[model samples]
Target chain A: MSLIGLISFIGTIIIFLLSKKVYKKMNWIILSPLLICPLIIIAILLITHTSYSDYNSGATWLSKLLGPATVAFAVPIYKNFPLLKKHAKAIGLSLVTGSAVAIISSFLFAMWIGLSNDMVNSLVPRSITTPIAMDISEIIGGEPTMTAVFVIVTGLTGSIIGPLVIKYIRIRTSAAKGLLLGMGAHGCGTSKAFEIGELEGTYSSLAMIVAALISIVLSDTFFPVLQHYLVG
Target chain B: MYMKIIKIILQIIFLYGILLLGDGIARLVHLPIPGSIIGLVLLFTALQLHIVKLEWVDLGAGLLTGELLLFFVPSAVGVVQYDQILGVIGVKLVAVIVLSTIVVMACTGLVADSVQKRGAKKA
Candidate 1:
């Protein structure tokens, strides 16, 4: 087998093993690849001198699978239709508001910090999942790859701190917790929400779908105008 | 059991078709959103509009959701290559993630809670 293929196999096995162990331990932060994998890889690269291109040569195979994986998300959304229907209005309102805030706040903050337009556009989609965020970043003339990094970091942060914030604020409803986390943070937040309970997971799943939809709309509509203004 | 398998396979095909259609629309219009995401939105819209029955895709969608984490593996691995970027931007990245998440959660929570309470009051 090729070196890339060999690495892919090993990477899969390691991820599988770690995922199982982390799931069993119920350690949302550690169990999540969004948090653990990046930290581990960063540590490896920092200690060693491996180039990203070399790693990506192997990792791209896995990356290609992202599309199919995303297509598969339809399954979950289908399964939870009843729950979604029950909270449709609430979900809709929350998704629109949450998505707007996520992109707008990031943009405003990036601007305040005097980061370049590219950086602002990259950060605008930080709250969305990587693939979608990358597309948005590219459309807006930001570096898709950099946007991917911000997406991962955003996801990990959401997964880690999401639940704690819920508890701290005394938000007790599983539905509320899940919706907030998923809408604001995407997959990582959904994973953490799942750790709390099935109700939380269900709501998180619904939120994830809704958030994706809202972000898509925003990327197509609001972002283009923002991009034009920033670039011009 | 055979029927279930066939249904799952068919649903996958339909989902793929939706993704492609969305992608085509995006390309034609020069839209920023990818086809898959457009497909997701379309699917959700269809569901809301009752154009497609939820039962048609339930099983497959369930399986996908269960393993959504697996899909992120490849990109997560790329983090291995970004060590230097992580070092220089690590603090900023961390700040962004931490602050953004908190702000999102707090804001969403406030909105949802107040909305629910308002609905309750009207009820």
Candidate 2:
């Protein structure tokens, strides 16, 4: 039992490494590791008749590293602070407006479509990164697991349509492109930003983090009450 | 080679230490934010304050954060556990996520672009 778990855990790393090469060869978003790696792992487990619980005993190690990796995100943010500092005023204003719009629109849209209040609440934190979004979802009385799903779908949405949006919209600046992707898509969007350029990646990282902080304050302190009044 | 290895190890330790400190403060203050984010903020402050140098963490941060998506797999697989819940509202949820993401991206891009253009004009 333990052996299967360990093998499955290590198998994830090897598969991911292999997927990277596949990604390089295919060069398609549909074939990207984020979508593919998980599918492969799930397939392997299903074939072997290994329970998700058994497979996860080892997989949890990789998951645990996520927190520290998030902490490490500060390094790049720190390195890029100087460039971001110059646009502090712009970043500040845009982030506030963007975050507010994300929360309000998602909440209203979910409600308008006749979903439950809890579903709307889950959608509220969908625009931000997973770790922070999951935390916010709990505070706002949304389902964390559902919130994660929303976050991934959001990222996938951005990854698919992000470039088209940029090209047609004529955003014209790397900064705006970064912010658009980061604020809308979160981590995967940040990945797209890097693909565009260094400056875009930096700006997207800033956008992601700023939007995250704004959501934390609003969701934890105010969103629960807001949800009650709006939905009730 | 040995010195380089030590440097990398020390860098990871420093980052982990920073993360722990952030976690402690967050627990103490009862902040709504995650410890990792607080750690990011603290690390940012440390960088600005010159409490730590950028080079110490450059490699480690790049290596880890570059592959950040892998860490998200476990939580994502939780979707498998939610088959029944998903069946109820999966279609609507997907619609909302797709449409809302497009709108949000456009709105954010428009706001940032207009503000940045104005900033440039002023400068």
Model 2: per-residue Cα lDDT over A98-187, one tens digit each:
788888889877887899877788888999988889998888788987888888778867777888888888999888998888888887
lDDT of each: 0.70, 0.81
TM-score for each prediction?
0.78, 0.91
lDDT of 2: 0.81
Ten-residue stretch with the least lDDT total in model 2 chain A: A219-228
- TM-score of predicted chain B, candidate 1: 0.77
Task: Supply candidate 2's per-residue lDDT for A110.
Answer: 89
What is candidate 1's local distance difference test score?
A: 0.70
Interface RMSD of 2: 1.7
Candidate 2 wrongly placed segments (more than 4 Å): A220-229, B1-10, B85-88
lDDT by residue (B14-71, candidate 1, tens digit) is 7767878888989999876677767777887787688988887777666555555555
